[model samples]
Structure formats: structure tokens, C-alpha cells
Target: MLKENLVNILRTLQRERVFLLGSFVTLLIILGGLGFSFTEASEGGSFLKRFGEGLWWAVVTVTTVGYGDVVPKTSEGRLVGVALMVGGLLSFSLVTATVASIFIERKFRRERGLETLKETHHILVLGWHHDGETLLDQLLRRLPHTARVVLINQLPPEKMEGIRAKYPGREPLFVWGDYSREEVLLRANVRQAYKAVILAGRNEGETAAEVDQRTLITTLTLKSLSPKIRILAELLRMENKPYLERAGADQVLIRGQYDSSIMAGALASPGLYKVVDALLNAEGFTVWAVDVPSEFQGSPVKTFSDYLKNQHQALLIAIFSEGRALSLEDLLGDEPSSIDEFIRSKFVETGMTHLFGRAKMKFQINPADHQVLGPHDKAVVIAAQPPNL
Candidate 1:
């Protein structure tokens, strides 16, 4: 491992020739200063004072600072100063160009999606649009300041710049590419991400199938990379639901389903949509997950709700259970209609599929108020204050 690391260091130095050259020049200047300082000390000068003066002279000459507070009276020291001043000019030019080139290279990498991110447990957003910006705003408001968010989208660096400008004080890294490609996904560090929110990708005049197809492709790639990551995907067609789950999506939301329901309700009763919107506002209501208490096992659901509200000021809303999330019925159909089912079922038993999807939860909303709570059940609650993470 040490030998491999040495080889990598050598390769890095070779690539960063300007850095190597600058270091060499600095060493040479320091050695020259030390020699001159020692020579002066031999002539009854204080060693530390002479050495500090020599170093100061070397820096001032190199940077063209030349404050002229101290000067070497010896002929040999003057020649040394001239050589250092010349070398300093060269080094200064090299350093300035190197810094500029580094910025240009970073710009190109951001434009072409070539940089690999090294963050852990950050939220990875797969698709860019107005929805991406809205999600970012909501995430910042909900999460702490230290939380990081990354985007993998087809937006140019210019649009990404606009995003940064519009959302000042927060910097989000973005990779520009088709997120389904393994290289692009790795560039975004999908395996290390905590959760991925995949918005359906579409262009102007594109069909629903085409948009959901892109989302499916991205989901499959994400699942292939990390099964443990929580994946929330959007689907336009309800028929495409099983496909997304089989691709290892943890939470699948149908497009227009929530909005259409709210709109229909509004039609029946004017201003009903406003009430629902107010209730679901990102800042107004918070949905949190709470641990199941051992004492509440087999107790009535209403009893648990009362305990939570009285103790923690939270309202019991739903039960989130990891069990029953996946089954032969979901992967296959009511009947095993084809040989494909045999192969696919066995394929899912592989390590990768088990890693990503086997831990998915089945959220049951408003379990009968009088129903008994199970041992492994979690209460999904709406509360003014957040539950412990």
C-alpha cells in the first residue's frame, strides 16, 4: 500500500509540475538564505537575527515586496539576492497561471459532469427543473444548516450558476449528465448518498411513457449502486408502479394523484384545497417518525395516540412497517404467468436487490383507532416539534 501511494504521489507531482517547481525554488532560496546567514554569524552577527533577516529578504525579493528595511552589505549576499529576485519573478508568474488554470479546469468539470464528489449521506437529486429548486428550498428549511444536498441533472453550468445566485449562502454541487449512466451516478456518489429523490425526466412534448421511462432507468441504476439508500421516485402512470418497486424504489408517488384529488375536492367544496394546502404547508405541519414503545405493544391505537400527545405533543397519523413491502404478488402478478417470473424471483434473491429493496416500508395510514399496535410497528406522527432522529 505504501508503494502504491508513493507511485500515486509521483504521478500527482508529475501532473502538477508548477507546484513541484515552486517547491524546489522555495527550498533553494531557503538554503541560500541559511548559508548567507551562517556566514554573517561567523563574522560576529547573531545567527537567529541574520537568518530571519535573510529569509525576510528572500520573501520580499521574490514577491517584489522590497520594503528595503534591511540590506545585505556583503558582495556574495547581493549576488544571491539578484538570483532570488529573478527566480521569484518566474515563480510568481507560474503560481498565478496555475491558480487561474485550476479555476478554468473546475469550470469545465462542472460543465461536463466529470468531477467525482466525496461527500457522505447527502441528499442526491436526480433530475433538474423548477421542481428541483422547490425541493432544495424545502429541504434547507426542514434540515439543519450542516446538511448537504447534491444534484445530478442535465442542466448546464450556466443554469447551475443561476441556481447558486438565486439561493445565496448555500452551495450545492451538481453533475451534468444522464443520471442512469453508471459513471455519472458514481460522479454524484450515489452509493454514499442517504436518500435520492428522482423526479421524472421529460422534454417539451414528451409522452408520459418516455418521462417515466427515464425515471425507471435512473432508479434501476441507483438500486444497482446501493440498495440500502432510500429511493423516492415519481411515476406518471399507475401501471408503471410495480416496475419502479421492482427496480428497488422504496417510496413511489404517482404524479397528479395528490393534486387531482385536492382539485376534485375543491370542486365539491370551494376553498377546500386551500385548507388542505395550509395543512400540508412545508413550514406549518411536520411529519415525523417515532419509535414504538415496548409498553404499547398489543395496546389499543387510541391509547398510544393519547400517550404520545400527552407526553410528546405528537399526533399519531400512520404506521410504518418494513414488513409486507415486497412479495411475490408485487414482483410477479396474481398468477405466475411466464418463465420470466421464475428467473426474476431468483434474481431478486441476489445480494444487490436484497440490499436496496428488502428494507422498504409499507406505510398504513390511520390504522383503526382502536386497533392494537404490533411489536415492530412505528408510529408516523404529525407534531409541532420533531421527534428524535
Candidate 2:
């Protein structure tokens, strides 16, 4: 504790050295002015009156206010005034220097992403991409207005003027740096974050592969720092999905694949895009993950489906479990099962089974009645509005 206190004191001194110097000089000036006041008390200056007046004069002198309410009547007092004037100049110089340094330091943090945030339960958005503005808008609309956020990306400081302007008072802290670096992640406080969304910053580098590669590196670094943090990452290459999964990313979006699939769907089924757009809209009827009834546990999938339709007045579309969507892959005991196993084992090991219990996500359009409902099974229902998360 003593060593920690010493380190803290040193840090404070380092940070406030200029202010401290100004204060020291101001104190000296006050003392000297008072000494001169005492020396010249018999020469038309009152010792008690002049000393009190001298202190106020010294302050006004430092501030360059020059109210002139009090004046030194003796030569000695005039000499003290000269000393005070010099000190005043130095003090004001220090004040200007401090303000300029503070502005420069803030600019440096904005440019280099050097802020070490220590907030808890914050949602971190890493890697600003081509779609970043759109993402930001949607996120702002969907998330609670009060949710704290940190955005770490490689965008230059000047390029972020739009974001600052748009947010006005509630701008998510912008950490302009390489997200793949541990120090940059530290700036965003990955360990304390509730979740993270990693965008594929195509503009930061050359090819799609390059973007995905950087994203993969960032995912690995984040997982290494905080294994429990839920990370959603975008990958341009489908092949990079495995790396993200291995790196413990909870959700991975293959950008090219989704765009291609959606385009194909649009081509095959005209107006399908409109329906999807409506479903994904932040403020509209959208697919939401909701808790299954406690009574539905161990019941067949059909039972929960009926309950959701009857009770919530919603369509039970799918169940999302583990990390990604529950699918035919899970029924086949393939990818989803492996991930589920990993999640189960990890949750049990860390006594975080409650989180898993709350995150039960399984899926079926019209599942067989024989298939039982599992604990932590959340129902993805198409509802009129999103629930409070």
C-alpha cells in the first residue's frame, strides 16, 4: 500500500508539475509582497491593512486584472510590485502552457488512441469500416441511449469530425489505433467490456483478406485478455471464420458470404430484401431473443412454440444457443455441438453456467415434438418491437 501510494503520488506530481510550479511561484510572490508590506507600514502603508491588501493585489497581478483598488505607497512596496509583475507574467505563461499542453495531450489521445479506459459493462466497437457510420447509427438507435461505448479503429483524428458532430454530447470515445495491438485493446478496456463488435476495416488496409487477417489478430488478442467477453467479429473471407472461433469470438459474420447470399435471395425472390430490411430495422418489428418459460424446460420443441405463439403473440422462428445460430448442423452433431460442448465446459468450469442458462439458443422452424427443450434455451421470435436488453 505504501509503495502504491508512492507511485500514485509520483504520477500525480508528473501530471501536475506545471500547475504545481505556478502555485509555488504564486505563494512566493504573496509572501514577498506581504514582507514588503510589513517593511513599508510606517511609510503611508498599514501593516495589517497593507498585508491583507497586498495578498489580493498579488492575485490580481497574476491574473492581469489590475483592479487598482490597492496601491503600494513606498519604494520598497514598488520594488515588491515589480517582483510580483514578473511573477505574474510567469504564472500566466504557466497557465497558458498548461492549457495548451492539455489540449495537445487530448489531441494525441484522439490521434494515437492512447486512452486507458477503466469503465465496466461498456460495449466496445472495434475497427471502423466502410459501413461504420451506418453501424453507429443503428447501434445508437437500438442500444439504450445511456449505454457507454468505446470505438477503437485506425481512422485519423480529422476523419472523425462527423462522428463527434453527430453524437454531440454522447460520442463514444474514439481510440484511433491498430485494433490488433494489445495496447490499443487496453485503451478500450477489453477486460471490463460487456461485449465487442469487430468490424472489418477495409479502408485501413489493402485486400479483403488483409482486413480479415487484421480482424483475426484483434479477436485473438481480445480473447487472450478477457476470455469471458462476448466478441462479434466480421470476416471478409469464409476461411477466416475458424480462426475467429479458435480465438474465442462468440459471433463471426462472413461479410462477403452474407452479401452474396442476400443478393441471391433477392434475385430469386423479388421483394425478399424489403422483408429482411424490415426485420433488421432497429426500431421496428424484428427478430428478438427471449426467455423460454420455466415450465417449458424438458418439454418438446412444439410445446415452447405453442406457448410463444399463445403467450407472447409472436412467431417462434428459431432458437439461438452456444455462440452462433442453432441449425441443422447442431442436429447432425457437427459444428454447433462442438461449440456447445466448449461453451458448456467453460461455463461449468468458471461457475458461469447461469450465463449459459440464460443464453439457451436453439433453433427449428417446426421442430419435432420428440426433441426436448434444454435449459438456457432462448427463443428467437419475430415480434413488433425489441425488448429491453
Candidate 3:
């Protein structure tokens, strides 16, 4: 852990270039102090004879803020002082120029989306479409203000600037490159990202199949880099959903999958689509799914619903679970039964070994009122904000 922390600190300093400035300053101070103390040693009981006093004198001299409180009384001491003064002027000028150059280079790199990010647990949005700005806006609205985001794409710097301008204080970092490439992902710090949202690219002249293929490759690359990262991917065709899932995406959303149903509903009943749109896109209120609190375990669905409504002003409309969850140890058992071997063999044969330790997610909307809440059960509700409970 200590070594890992040290590596992380070094990585941060390297990215920020703070170590350069610190090392230069420390070296100059130490050398100046040692030289001053040795040269003034003949002056017995002189404050400059002490290393601490020499350091103070060195600081004032290097900064050219001579207080005249400590002066060299001998030829050797004066020679040392002259050397320090010349070194200080030359060194500080070089340092000032170098610092300015560094800042300018960093700014240029950032504006051109060529900078490597150091943000951890940030959300990564890869690829882009014509309506990508809307997706970014929604993500920013849903995420907390403290949440960091990095966007990886080939969009122009001007486009990125316009997008940043739209959100005054919540602008996301940008990396200009092909999102499917591992190098670009590394530049965006994909290994440290909490989650990644892969969108189907609408690059000029690219077909839908090509776009879906790119999305699949991006998902595979991301999972290889960070197996624990949660990936939410968009698919242009419903047929590509299983491929994306096999690529290790946590969730796959097919473009316009619900459009037909919504359109039919709107035709059958006037204003139905408007209601659906409001529920999904309206300000102030939206749907959320929260795990059942321990205190409400085994409570009836109706009871829990009532509690949410009364305590948090949230309307509970559904109770659901992500299927029957099981751990690897539970499936394998201590004795390693034939059944365990059989399950393991099947997972390996299907090239879905990763799924062996994961539960398949499924949602059951609006369960019976008398149904009791289980440990894995979650309540789906419409609320202004997430409830504290």
C-alpha cells in the first residue's frame, strides 16, 4: 500500500510538473546555505556560522530582498555572497521563463485536447453523435456538481469550446482521438474512471454497422483496461445488443427502441407521448431506483410504498430485483460438487467466464402490494431528488 501510494503521488507530481519546481528550489537553497556557512566560519559566534542563519540569508539573497541584517565581514564571505547573487539572478530568470513556458504548453495542449488527465473516479463519455450535447447536458444534470467528466472523441477544439461554454462551471475535459484506441483511452485515464458511456459515432460517411462495430471495440478495450468499470453503451441496431453485452457492457441501450411503442401509444391515446416525455425529461422530478433500506426489510410492498410517500414525498410505482443473486463461493461450494464443475464448464465453454460471478439484472415493475421486500429488492419511484434513506 505504501509503495502504491508513493507511485500514485509520483504520477500526480509528474503530470502536474510540481516536482520540477520543488526540486530546483530545494537544491539552490541547500547549496547556498552550505557555501555561506563554510565561508563565514572564521567569524566566531557570527550568526552566519550557523547553517540555519545561512539558510535565512540565502533566501533573502536569492529573492533579492536583502534586509542588510546579515552581512559578510571577510573577503571569502563576500566572494561567496557575490557568487550567490549572480546565481540567484540567472537561475530565477531561467526559472521564470521555464515556468511560463510550461504553463503556456499545458494550456495549448489542453485547448487542443491533447492533454492526459489525472482525475480519478471520473465519468468517461466516449464517441459522439449529432445530439451528443443533449446527452452530455443530461449527464451533468443528473450527476453531482463534484463529479468529474472526461470526453473522448475526434471533435474539433471549437466544438468542444462551444460545448464547454454551454455549461459555465461544469465543463468536461476532452481528449481528441479515436475512442476505440487503447492509447486514447489511457490518455483519458480510463483505468481510473468510475463509469464509461459509449455512444454510437455519427462520423461523416460512416455507416450504422461501422459505428456499432466501433462501439463494440470500444467496450472490449475499456473492459480490458478496467474490468470493474461500469459501461453503458448505445447500439444502433437491436441485433448488436448481445454482442455489446458479451463485450462486458453493464447496460446496452438500443437507439429508438421505445419509439414504436411510444408512437403507438400516442396514436391510441392523445397526449400519451407528452406524458412519457415529461416523466423522462421534465425538470424537478424524474424516476429513480433505490435499494430497500435494512429497516424496511420484509415489509409489504404497500407498507414500503406508503412510508416513501409519507416520509420523502416519493411515489413508489414498482418493486424489483436483478434476478436471484449468487456468489462464486455459493455456486462452487466448499466440497466442489459435480454441479459446480458443470456450471464452471458451461461458463468457460460459452466464453462468458466473467458472468459466472455476476447476477443477471432483470426488473419486475409494479409487483403485488402484498409482496414482501427482499434483501436485493429495490423500489422504483418518481421523486424530485434521491431520497436519503
Candidate 4:
């Protein structure tokens, strides 16, 4: 019974207008008593009569229904009654306005599932968790400052607000919904996004099967909607990597596999880890992709190196043929019918890695090994260091 009463009290408190009404009524009664007492002391009226008049005055002041039936003759009594009346009205209005707003917002959200987006070429982040937040911070740091990132998560407003307060600056537009649903992705404007990052949901006690199921659903939905959008997903399990890739994700970062691969490479050579870390971090030995023009069809790789030193102030790294192959052959001597063919032949001759679905230039490989020049080939060069480091 006691718990029930407490719950009732909390419910009543939530209906703030009722509290406001009761407060106004109580204030009126108090004001009336004070007014009657003051009038009695001044006019020498009977105690009962003074009390009655004071009650009347208090009621009128509190309700703002001043009937002028009983008046405050003393300056002190009048001032007190006036203060109480103003306080009562202000308090009542504030409470009523707050209650009304709560109802209105709830109704609005019920009618509309989520908000819309306007910016183009922006990134869309699905789900909100520790991993999501980390990815958001990294993207904000890496991408151009003007780029917009929209967050779609299933968390409530209070929870989302708490997460948002930690990040001060232009916050990403947030869409709260179950990310597995196609409607939620559509609401987030996934179709127009430049990239989509699907993060793993935190399911501490849940079975791995359930978690993988959820991740696969989200990935499939995103691909179905915008097949062209570059989807970078994080797959927790190694077995799920193929599913994510088949779902059309441009890149899948398998946490375990990636770490293991790096570790394995590092075990072979300690410097390998440092180089890989620097390259991935876009720091120290950075890699940039520089384009090769059509006019330089027959220009040797050496000429490009000279140009980088003098013009772009960058070192000429390995060039990716139009077919994305790194080669160790002479590019100028091998005259091909088309630039694309030339790059293809050169890339095959030299062993290089090409990241999928992205244009590239020469980067951290042996440029001396591949000396081919193609209109579409590029050079990825490292630039300067971070500021204030």
C-alpha cells in the first residue's frame, strides 16, 4: 500500500498542472488570513470579523479574481497580497506550459518517426555505442571540417543527450530509431550518404549468433537501399567477414583478423608495424595520391619524380597503373595503345596492393621498380607532420 501511494504521488507530480492549481489555492487562503489580520489591527474590528475579511482578501488575491469585496487598507497588507497574486499566476503558467510542451513533443514524435537531412556527400553512422562514438571522433578528426555526419541510433533522448554533452562543438544530427529497419536508414538519408559506418551493438549477455544476426541485417538493409554508398562495417567475428562483404560493404574491418595480421607482419619485422601504423594514422610517413596527366603519356617515372621534388614538394612514391597494379617495369619504354592498358601492364609487372573501389596514386612502395607513365596513374606522397606535435 505504501509503495502504491508513492507511485500515485509520483504520477500526480508528473501532472504538474494539478500541483500548480493546489499551490495557487493554498496561497490564496494564506494571503486572505494575513490581509484580514492586518485590517483588524488597523481598524479595531472584532476578531471574527477581521478574520473573515482577511480570508476573503486572500481568496481574491490568489485566484486573481479580485472582486473588490474586501480591500487591504494598510500598505503592508496590500503589498503582501499583490506579491502572492503575481507569484501564483507566474507559477501556474510555468507549470501549465511545461506540461503542455511535454504532450506536444510526444505527439509530434509519434506522428513522425525521425528527422530529415539536407547536406550531401556526408557520412552516416548507424548505432550508438562505445565503438560508434570512437569512430565518430576519428572521422571528425580525419575528414574535412565542413563535412556533416548524421547519427542514427535507438537510444532515448535523455541517453542521447548525455552522450552528446561529452562532445562539444557542432554536433552531428541524430536520428533515434532501430537501425535494423529500412525506415530508419531512409530517415537518416542513407541513400545520399558518401559513406556508412555500421558499428557493432553492445550485447553483453546475448549469444554471438544473435549479435551477428543483427549486424548482418543492418548491413543488408543499407546495401539494398544504397548499393553505391561506400559501407565500412566492423565485423566482430571472422566468419561474418564474408557475409558483410557479400552484403556489399566496400570495406570490412575485422577487429581480430586485422589485429592478428598486423601482429603477424610486425613479428616478421618490428619496423613493419611502425610503418603500417604511420601509414594508417595519416601521420609521420603519410601517403597521398597524386594524379598523372594524359599529356605525360610517354614520360618516364623518373620525370614524375623530378616534378614531385620541384613542383609539388613531395617524393614520388610507387605509381598505381590505371588497373591498380604496381609494377617494376620501365613505363616510358613500354608504349601502349591506351593509358589504361599501359597502367594495367605496368601494375601486373610490379607487385602492389590496391584498395578496392577507390582512386589512388603512387604510395609507399618501390617507385624505382615501376617506371610506367599513364594518364590515369597517380603518386601517393607523404606530406608534413601534425601541427604543434
Cα distance off (Å), candidate 3, residue 124 = 1.9
lDDT of 3 at 43: 60
- In order of listing, the candidates' clash counts read 1, 8, 0, 16
Model 4 lDDT per residue over 85-172, tens place: 8876876677677767765865455334365544577798877666666666667766667888887877776666665566677567
Q: What's the TM-score of every candidate structure?
A: 0.75, 0.71, 0.75, 0.53
The 0-to-1 C-alpha lDDT of every candidate, in the order given, reads 0.75, 0.70, 0.79, 0.65
How well does model 4 score by local distance difference test? 0.65
Q: Could you tell me how far off, in angstroms, the CA of residue 37 lies in candidate 3 after the best superposition?
A: 10
What is the overall TM-score of model 4 with all chains considered together? Answer: 0.53
Q: Which candidate do you rate higher for TM-score, 2 or 4?
A: 2
lDDT of 3 at 18: 59
Predictions ranked by lDDT, top down?
3, 1, 2, 4
- Residues 1-389, candidate 2: write the lDDT tens digits: 57865765467556868658767776866786686678667756467777777788777776778898877777877787788788778777876787677668756865455656656788989877678888888777667767887888767667775675688667877777777888888878788887899998677338988887778667656755776678889888887686566545667888766677778888988689878877866436777777766788899888877766776677777765554442222222355556455544543454432321112234566556677877777777787754322
Q: Give me the candidate number with maximum lDDT.
A: 3
- Best of the two (1, 2) by lDDT: 1
C-alpha lDDT (0 to 100) for residue 54 of candidate 4: 82
Report the lDDT tens digits of candidate 1 across residue range 1-389: 57865765466546868668778678867976785695456455688878888887777777889899866677877788788878888878887787677668866876566777777789888886657777787777667667788888877778787786675676777788888788988988888898899888677898999988888777767766776788889888999887777666777998777877887899998777766676566556667777788898889999988888888788888987776446434555555554435436544654443433456456789888888888888988887666553
